[model samples]
Target: MATRATARPRSIDFNAAELMVKTIKGLTMDAVQKANSGHPGMPMGCADLATVLWTEFLVHDPSDPQWFDRDRFVLSAGHGSMLLYSLLHLTGYDLPMSELQNFRQWGSKTAGHPEYGHTPGVDVTTGPLGSGFAAGVGMALAERFLAARYNKPKHRIIDHMTFGVVSDGDLMEGIAAEAASLAGHLGLGKLIYLYDDNHISIDGATDISFGEDVAKRFEAYGWHVQRIDGHDHPSIREAIASARDDERRPSLICCRTTIAKGSPNKANTSASHGAPLGADEVAATKEAMGWPADPFHVPEDLRYALGEQMPEHAQNREDWDARLIAYREAHPELAAELALLIAGELPSQTFAGFDALLEGFEVGGAIASRKASHKILSKLAANHPTLLGGSADLAGSNGVLLPDTPGQSAAHPEGRNLHFGVREHGMAGVCNGMALHGGVRPFDATFLVFSDFMRGAVRLAALMNLPVVHVLTHDSFWLGEDGPTHQPIEHAMSLRLIPNLYVIRPGDAHETLGAWRLAMERKHGPTALLLTRQNLPTLAESRAEDVARGAYVLLDPAGEGDLDGIFIATGSELALAREAALRLAEQGERIRVVSMPCWEAFAEQDAAYRESVLPPSVGRERHLAVEAGSTLGWERYADHVHGIDHFGASAPAEVLAEKFGFTVEGVIERWAQIR
Candidate 1:
């Protein structure tokens, strides 16, 4: 398709930026008019600034769309989707006008909002007000992590910016405020946002709900702010340039413009906010802009002129490819590794190295699931250059980020890890964006108790089937002294309710490693690793590979397995189940102890596997379970469960375990009652 747009402007001065913007506005309007549907107000309003960025500043190759170093552009106010769609089509991205014709229709490439993995050149999904803004933060954060880790003096391998075109609605969302504050605090120098201040929202002017000093608020959050008249192409270009030149702080460029610039009666009117301008309004707008081409049509001369420029973009990509090829000569291994990583493929050595490391931990140690998770995560991070993660203000406590890979402090385009500020919800949402961005495996960490704050994004992760692992620690009330607020009495059971999620609460070190292995292998859904805060002895019989089986018979009566009693347990209480089995053995009660670590994984197994573990028709009259959290999900395993159904209180670890009934004695006592 021709990259050119519109016939000659036939104006006194031929400004490329103005012409580009006007061309996009004209095209978007025509598409809407043709389709009889779409949101066109922002496209008409902010086209100038958007064009200035794309033509002058944006580093992208339409010919090679997946270029790693390409600048990311997000349409945060997805209601103005025609702005992005028309740009993608006119700027020579893979999207064609036919896709625009199919806009908002089922099975069409162009959805109401840009969906990740569905559209080419669309970086992240954006629709729910602040979600796109938060995703922009993630894109900028991803760029930072990659830049910090891989960029060298000679090779600027990861020095790209994340830019977003946002509207008043995006600013109104609380999540946007949360993300903006965090982004500023981290000094994300390369995040340049262009705010389209048309002053119009769906409910009319933004004065009704949004009246905060955004400039002052962002400045307080530690960002560089610049304000420009949105219609002044030169001024907009200058602000974009300044933001690009900045190296110490992130930037926000506020561009002031009219809502609908040329619809005559509808210009700056609330009527233009959603619906397309009427036939008379469209003709009137076209006449005022001096556009003579028929609706849904462009002159061949302009098409040819723009077609010549396609080579300019193609050459940029071709040159980058040539540089990469030359770089491969001197650095074959690095080049090959990067090639695989960019393609979302793991290095062959990753699986091999992981297995070698697994051998050492097979025997396992008496370590808490949390501590064991760290050991395994640290080892994996050591070998996998692509592994990156951080906690939601809980790094030291959660053991998610190891010491070697420093926490991502600056928003460098290539940093390996990110330190998400106290916004747990924003952190989870951003990690979702990173994983969906296609070039990274992003992870987030937080205390298991704070998981309530992140449940929305966690559900989104499961819904989208993104492999964003949540490293959840302090999994139960065994996290003594912190009391009820810090304890996760119901979180584990709560997460189990997610359909495709894998909720793994490993018993010991070996099992922790096993959980990570399964998590990586099950790439279709989110995985929550519920690691314990307190240490528990890595039991003698428990193994990592066995834990990967979801649930297994750890200890059972040697003969006549038609059990009189059976004990089920997870985490530290596995030993209690063993103890209960031993006590039952003395009474000549045939007993089986089942270690159920991952409910989601066990549920995925066939009926035979689940039946073998839980026994479809349990003949045992005595059945009991020992765990340190709410007895919500475990009730199916046994009618009588010895667990903390209520909140915990401040106390010593041993004292709390005894008080909460998470003990061998408790399981034995509960077992006797079941009998």
Candidate 2:
């Protein structure tokens, strides 16, 4: 929340609003009918609210979906995706009628859920119950942060609003509660959510499971609350207008809408919530609403009216472009920085000077990998304006603080360090928002074990191919004193299972920095950096460049003879693997110690490179995978795996290591007889 500045009220003509609503409903009904599988109730119910927001309130240029200053509208109740698709089509986005006809079909952009990059106007991929609700908070925070950093007395280049239509299910989710609390605490005035208070869910009436007073709940979270008749255009406009006046809190307008606003039979029932309306019901509903019988048909006059609205939104973008040009002439350096940030580029020096930095970063030291990542962040934040993130209230423990910046809060909104409280699930969603917002590179940190709480958001990030970094520390049984409750036994292997998600368990300080570098550079998807809680000795042969290859030979067999076995490991276990290999060498066994830091990254390597690391001749039973985690996924890489498949005990690091058979001697003994 920055200073309160009342946004001028803008209204769509009543006739146009009514037509738009009718068109939206018609499209939603027909799309669901055509798809034979999708939700239509929400789209029909919230049509009026969405119509007002899009035509009157949302500051977007459909032609230029990536306009930096455009307002974002997220459908948090994403099962009602037809609502978004209909709106996108009506608003002149690249979504054509043909795509609408092929709704939910394979190879079509109009998927069951609104996917971020797949759809032209979708701000973020949001299908899970409260994901969009939480992510909207992140988008608002990003806007406030950029506005504070870039906006001057008269040039408000970064000012924008984040709007979302949340469903009953979204409000019921704990993630939304956590995010809403944070948004209110941070005073995110630009964040406004219109809660579609239609009292039906998959089961039945929400009263069956959800009976809490949602307006009061939001008010308790420090939000500006308003309740309105959802179908009443005047109330919808008035509530949104009132919401814009309050800049000290996020706003939630609870609109009491019917499940299917004007349906003849299924209007207020659960029947219309998910399944498509039959042809007879659709026709009857259309006749009742005074809509045409033809599927996907919108009135010509309504289409023309909607077309006219696009120029108003496009003009704002054109004006912003002109102002950007003038601002560049007046302040060249700031303009260039802004351009680089929006393009997701770092400063020229940081981008090109990484080789030199890595060479210096290869200094050997016995330090926790978390501290090494902290060191990398310190250097990156010093030069990269786009670097921004925070831990889940674990800055001291997880080491995610930027040394020079103040914490982001209600008062100091310009600070780069975000304080995400203790909400790991909420933090992941917010990080996704910051990444989706473009210009800010956001990372979230928490202990590796708590990643289970945040996995839903992490999976969505991977699905959308967002470049969010998750700094997970206290990686394994090495986390010790916190005991079994805090240790991560299967986090590395489990996280590696996520498609397109890069899971890197770096060996030491240098490899830790390499993981950070990889996370920063990989823009196509999210990255999880698994670091150590205990201090790890730096290897003499640790090469920063070798990390990019995912797994590299840390120590080769002493003799030129055939390799007897390969000891593959990651994180703290790599050190033990090396020691075990050395001990085996004394007994005439030639074992190769390979540091496999990132399984996902290594899998992407060419067959030649992969074969070189794990040669086929000395394969299968000869390969021993050593790590203090579940042995579930190691079968892909090793024949015999030495890993903890049971819960750990409460003890010191050394005791836990020996108890779990993770020590060098333990590994050597196990390797000697395993085959």
Candidate 3:
């Protein structure tokens, strides 16, 4: 372990703090002005609050940005990314003054939004309004869970807080409401959010669109709510101190502020919300705040003064290092486990006997893929203590319940099962946070149809390449009797459109096991396992290992003389295609069946492997695709698609299968047309 030099505690210097705030404002205005395409108002208005929080309450070592116990600060209102960028530069993170100068530029660390892996100190990607707020809740949840599980008496290794600066837009977003309710219910006392109540939006005053009593609303949500002047340094400090002391509930400090605090003409108006303050207003703002006129210039004395606490921050990390060393000596096993988790490494024995676990499923027995997933998840969770998750009020339907685990709540911080209620959007965001928090592997479940609500967070997860699992059950119209509202027609293909998201619709119990294993092994990006609500027979030929290839030949023509055509299918339709191939074989026609459970995974395979499965020798026109959902992207592989392009009606799965031409005869007819 590395240790930073110890230093004497610095006295509270309000004068230096005020100068730091002005410098933050100057950096914000200059960076936005240089970019000519960024938000400056929010950063300007919230500088005082951010300055106090970072310099005083935030516990982080700039030298060791990945310190496990460091406090996480999320700029949830990410449009004002300059606020975070300036802080990172001043506090001596890898971000430099040049990067701030290159704000929003190509290849710069300072992006239009705060990106997690892209920036050294940024904890999570934040751009979509309430996503950061919700993810912060997840970070807090992770902290509480890990602390409860690993912290010993006099050895508090995982103690930390998740803080954020949210905007009016974030509070107005429904996702934030869902997350806020859950946070309050869980009593995540370490989660704190400073609401930038500037009362302004791009459409002008926020009252025109959002007029609710925000403080009263949070109070109703069971948070420790407070109101304060955002620009008042003393009030900001006091409010944060009070929030830190509240151990029974999450805290929300509503900070009233002007849009562009020091700008003469643009202050308190919508004009400065997103656009740069222009050269004239920049100079005027600088003059108004008694700041230097030079762009991107921070007085050397002020910079040195602001960074005086760096030694203290580094020393805090060094102290934690000592405690961790002591903790390892006292509890070697737990310390080892914590080390693996913090390093995001899985045990070597995690999958040592993986094949034996799959042997329990009878080859020809009928079972829903979702139910099979439950069995696999139960086994995996038993072996992988860090693997924990829950469904969004659909645990029964989604089969996301971990056997023998208590539901997570205020009273049960060590519980592995998280109850996300009906908040699909919030659940996804929270899962992202848990993944970003680094000690836990987070997954969430919901109906395949409800994934639409989580698209924003899901997309961000893929963009950040976070290894989060999304278990989506009731995968298609086969989830019948619930009408079109409950059916997922285009969801699988739609999710596949996301660059790094793997959408796997397992065909049977064996394939479901493969999906779970793949999800756990994948270290980057996210995976969506689409399981069935209706039971289907486990194919005798299905192999769990082959599922990793994304697609494989399930059934070839019997005593093949010449290959006639290939039948491609996924999920439940694999059985239908196999039957169709067998039926065609009986009729003296040679047909091949291909099971493609995951398009993204298969696409990742080498061209030779993909070619071996699809066999370009068999022309595209000779390929007939079978699936129960929309057939939009199947054309890439098959010329004839036997699928339901329209929404399904309320009926039994069998009845809908017949109505939608999903029978063996239907596959034969569709293959005939293509041939």
Each prediction's number of clashing residue pairs: 15, 1, 1
Q: Model 3: runs farther than 4 Å from truth?
A: 1-12
Query: Clashes in model 2: which pairs?
Result: 1-187
Determine which window of 10 residues in candidate 1 has minimal summed lDDT: 1-10
Candidates, ranked, TM-score: 3, 2, 1
Q: What overall lDDT, based on C-alpha atoms, would model 2 receive against the true structure?
A: 0.88
What TM-score against the true fold does each predicted structure earn? 0.85, 0.97, 0.97
Clash pairs for candidate 3: 465-525
As for TM-score, the candidate ahead, 1 or 2, is: 2
After superposition, the stretches of candidate 1 with alpha carbons farther than 4 Å from their true spots are 1-40, 260-306, 348-365, 405-417, 433-440, 463-465, 497-500, 521-525, 547-549, 564-568, 606-608, 615-627, 630-646, 653-660, 668-675
Query: Model 2: runs farther than 4 Å from truth?
Result: 1-11, 351-364
lDDT of 3 by residue, 1-675 (tens): 221111122345778788888888999998988888999999999998888888877889999999988989999999999999988998899998889999999999999999988999999899899999999999999999998899888777888888999999999999899999999999999899999999999998998989999999999999999999998988987888788788789999999998889899999999999999999999998998888898887877767776788888888899899999999999999999889978888865566556876787788788999999988888888888788899999999999899887999878898999999999999999999999998899999999999999999999999999999999999998988998899899988889899999999889999999988898889899999999999989889998888889999999986737689898989999999999899888888888899999888899999999999988889998888898888889988988888888998899888988888888888888877765
Instruction: List, residue by residue over 78-180, the lDDT tens digit for candidate 1.
Output: 8888788877877778887688877778787878777766778877777777777887887777777665655455554556678899888888876788888
lDDT, candidate 2, at 236 = 92
Better of 1 and 2 by lDDT: 2
- Model 2, residue 80: what's the lDDT? 91
